[model samples]
Target: MVDYHLHEAIKEAGLDLTKEQMVVLKKLHDEDGLNQNELAYLTYRDKSSLARLLSKMEKKKFIVRKPSASDKRVNQVFVTSYGKEIFESAKPFVGKLIKRMEHAISETEKQQIISILKKVQTNLS
Candidate 1:
């Protein structure tokens, strides 16, 4: 419930996001250093979208692309110093949202609920 609301609340809070941009940001937030394809798969975004967002983010000085020494064809995404600062600033808001989620249930209940949701996901698969 809270997870569902969180995205909407984020939008309501005047945080701007193109669909792909949000996914890219969230994916990077979770798992850094992913290649373009890997990042797209993880975020369920298309390559075209990633390309555009990457371009925009690069221009904004939020992220950098470094060529992989092992694979010349790929560039790993790394957050820049400014991106780190932005992420740090957003952490408190995320923390508050998490706290609100925790308030609605006990730790055990939260675990159980997440387990159930995961099971449902697996069951669908």
Candidate 2:
């Protein structure tokens, strides 16, 4: 439900990327050069799925994957100049998204929700 709303918001804002792609771009922007495995872990995506996402991003010229200098088999992901611009453009929307969510709940309720989610995660594990 939340994702659907956010997707609509992004579309209305004329952003051509999905929320998932925005997340990957955010991670890369924060940490410029991350290997594929690292990105997958950080984004909670499987390697194959991440590969598909990266392929789309690559085709859009938003990111580039280069073979690691130290490890030929490892591909490091980096945001291109175009990707940075996109990231910047998405910041205002992201900020609004954050603010909207935060404003919907009190701090205490937010903490409680976090605790409940953590317990749920522990149970699943």
Candidate 3:
């Protein structure tokens, strides 16, 4: 539901990005030049799926995959200037969604939820 709403919000904002694509864009924005495998791990997506997403993003001019200088076989992903702009534009929508989602939850409850989610993530890892 959250993902669907976020996708709709992006669409309403006149941005052509899915929630998944936004995730990739945000990750690259935070740390550019991440290799395909690294991105796969970070995004919890399989290599094939990530490759497809990257291909689509490349076509959209949101990102570029350059052959790594040290490893020609590895393609490092970087966000384009346009991608950064879109990401920046989407920040407010994301913030709004987060705020709305947490409106009924107190800070202490939010902290506990975070702690529990972290533990669950660790267990899965």
Candidate 4:
């Protein structure tokens, strides 16, 4: 599956990150200072599960969670300098994987796939 290929690509690129971690890292990098709730929602993870994942990422120094200035109960997540470095390191491999996938499919096929996926999502919702 695509996920398996992506995991291999990341490992072959010498990055010690999982696809889940990369996803979270990219999200945080794209929108720094997102609170835990926002990150959980964006990542499609429940609160407790996201917390555990964040805990591991925090231990890896990929991210830092700070108490919100406005609300003490909320924790804002930010990518550290090291996190940015890791994300930058993984970008090329991800890009290559994307290129390979795109090369394998025509634009029309890609659109059809997307449309079908959207309909599936609608049905699920």
Candidate 5:
């Protein structure tokens, strides 16, 4: 339901990105220079699947993969100018969604929820 809401919001806001693609873009925006393997782990995707996704994103000109200076074999991913523009444009919509989702929750409640979710994630890991 949350994903659907976010997808509709992005579309309504005139952004051309699927939720999955947005996840990749957002991650790259937050932390550039992540290699394909690191991105796969961070995004909870398999390496092969991420490679395919990266290929599509490259064709769209949303990202560029350059050979890492430290390791020639590693490809570091970075968002392009177009990708940054799209991410900036979608920021308001993302903020709106977050605000709506947290509407009824107090700060304390929000912290508690975060704590619980972290514990759950740790348990799973």
Candidate 6:
């Protein structure tokens, strides 16, 4: 499975991307300061599960969740300096296959592939 291959690649590359940590960090990278609900939707993680993961990340000093002044019920999540450093370190390793993937396919084909893959995902779900 691709998941197995991906896990092995991360291990072989000696990257520090725990499954939950990687998802949350990547979600933040793409869209910073997303509240917990927004994060759960973006990352496809349930709220309670994400909460536990966020708690651990907070303890590690990788992230901070602060209550919004505009809305006391809403808490915004932010990656810390340490998280940026760690995520930056992981990016190259996680993206190691990109060069090969791009090299092996034409630009047009890449677009077509992505379009077809999206349809496949929709159909499967």
lDDT of 4 by residue, 11-123 (tens): 99998888989999999888999999999999989999999999999999999999999999999999999999999999999999999989969889999999999999789
TM-scores for every predicted model: 0.70, 0.91, 0.95, 0.94, 0.92, 0.81
- TM-score for predicted model 6 compared with the true structure: 0.81
Residue by residue across 1-125, what tens digits does model 3's lDDT show? Answer: 98888987888788888898999998998899999999999999999999999999999999999999999999999999999998999999888888989998999999999999999999999
How much does candidate 1 score in TM-score?
0.70
User: In model 5, which regions exceed 4 Å deviation?
Assistant: none
Which sections of candidate 4 miss by over 4 Å? none
Worst 10 residues of 5 by lDDT: 12-21
Tens digit per residue, CA lDDT, model 1, 1-125 = 75566666556556543435545666787777889888877765688887778989888777888888899899899777776665655555666777876886888998899999999978975
Best by TM-score: 3
RMSD of each: 3.4, 1.4, 1.0, 1.1, 1.2, 2.3
**Candidate 4, number of clashes:** 0
- lDDT by residue (9-80, candidate 5, tens digit) is 899889878788889999998898799989999998999999999998889888999999999999999999
Instruction: Single out the weakest 10-residue window by summed lDDT for candidate 6.
Output: 1-10
What TM-score does prediction 4 earn?
0.94
Clashing pairs in 5: none
lDDT of prediction 2: 0.91
Q: Per-residue lDDT for 7 in model 3? A: 83
**Candidate 2: lDDT of 1?**
74
Whole-model lDDT per candidate: 0.73, 0.91, 0.94, 0.94, 0.91, 0.83
lDDT of 3 at 47: 100
For model 5, what is the C-alpha lDDT against the true structure?
Answer: 0.91
Query: lDDT (0-100) at residue 59 of candidate 4?
Result: 95
